[model samples]
Target: AQTVTQSQPEMSVQEAETVTLSCTYDTSESDYYLFWYKQPPSRQMILVIRQEAYKQQNATENRFSVNFQKAAKSFSLKISDSQLGDAAMYFCAYRDTYSGGGADGLTFGKGTHLIIQP
Candidate 1:
């Protein structure tokens, strides 16, 4: 079993600013995937970005990016030019590629409450 931790329960950022959410995990598997998901008011789990354990390069999508340190088992999300819509609960998730159970083997952190101020 694996566990993910988000030390900060909440974070705040002014509109159009930048913010980074930290995440760390413990796992015994050598190959896996890391993901950042955003859950808005609608309660939809939107994929923000993903990073492969074997890939040395970080993953980025538009205003969202991840700082993945495989050796340190840390994956943090950075949101640039943050928008009001970006205000939501962010989750750090992990999945083992060889799990063969799909979403069933996914482990997630408690989540960070992101407050976007005007």
Candidate 2:
């Protein structure tokens, strides 16, 4: 089994600035994937970034990036040039690939609410 944790319950950032959200996970399984998903008021889960346990390099998408410390089992998301559109509830998720190709649903963190101010 895997568990995700988001220590910060809420985060605020000024428009055009940068913000980093903290996340950590616990899993005895060596083959797994870590992800950051954003859910806005619209109630859709959007994939922000994903890191594979086997990959030494972190994953990044546009202004979104992750600091992945495999040894520490930490995966943090960094948002640059934050915009109002970025305001959403961010969740950290984990899935074990070893289990029949991850047929089970992902385990998600409680989430961190992000507010962007102009």
Candidate 3:
């Protein structure tokens, strides 16, 4: 079984600035995928980025990137050039590829509320 944790309950950043959201996971399985999802006021879970455990390089998308510390089991999200639209609830999710349950094997953390200040 895997569990994800977000230590910070909330984070605030100014527009055009950069902010990093911390995430950590505990898992006995070696093959898995890490993901950062953003849920806005509309309640849509948007995929921000994803990182595969076997990959040595961290994943990046546009202004979003991840600092993946495999051995330490840490995956943090960095949002650069933040915008007002970036404000949302961010969740860290884990999917065990070895589980064979597909999307059903996903485990998520309690989200962190991100607030963008103008």
After the best TM-score superposition of candidate 1, give how far the Cα of residue 82 lies from its true spot, in angstroms: 0.7
Q: Output the better candidate (1/2) by TM-score.
A: 2
**Residue 40 error for model 2, in Å?**
0.4
Tens-place lDDT digits, model 3, residues 1-118: 7889999999999999999999999999887899999999899999999999999999999999999999999999999999999999999999877545445556899999999999
**Distance from true location, Cα of 21 in model 2, Å:** 0.3
Query: Over the stretch 54-110, how does candidate 2's per-residue lDDT look in tens digits?
Result: 999989899999999988999999999999999999999998875665466899999
Ranking by lDDT: 3, 2, 1
RMSD of 3: 1.2
User: Please, what are the lDDT tens digits per residue for candidate 1 over residues 1-118?
Assistant: 8999998899999999999999999999888999999999899999889898999999999999999988899999999999998999999999888656555567999999999999
The residue pairs found clashing in candidate 3 are none
Model 3 TM: 0.95
Q: Candidate 1: where are CA atoms >4 Å away?
A: 100-104
Better of 1 and 3 by TM-score: 3
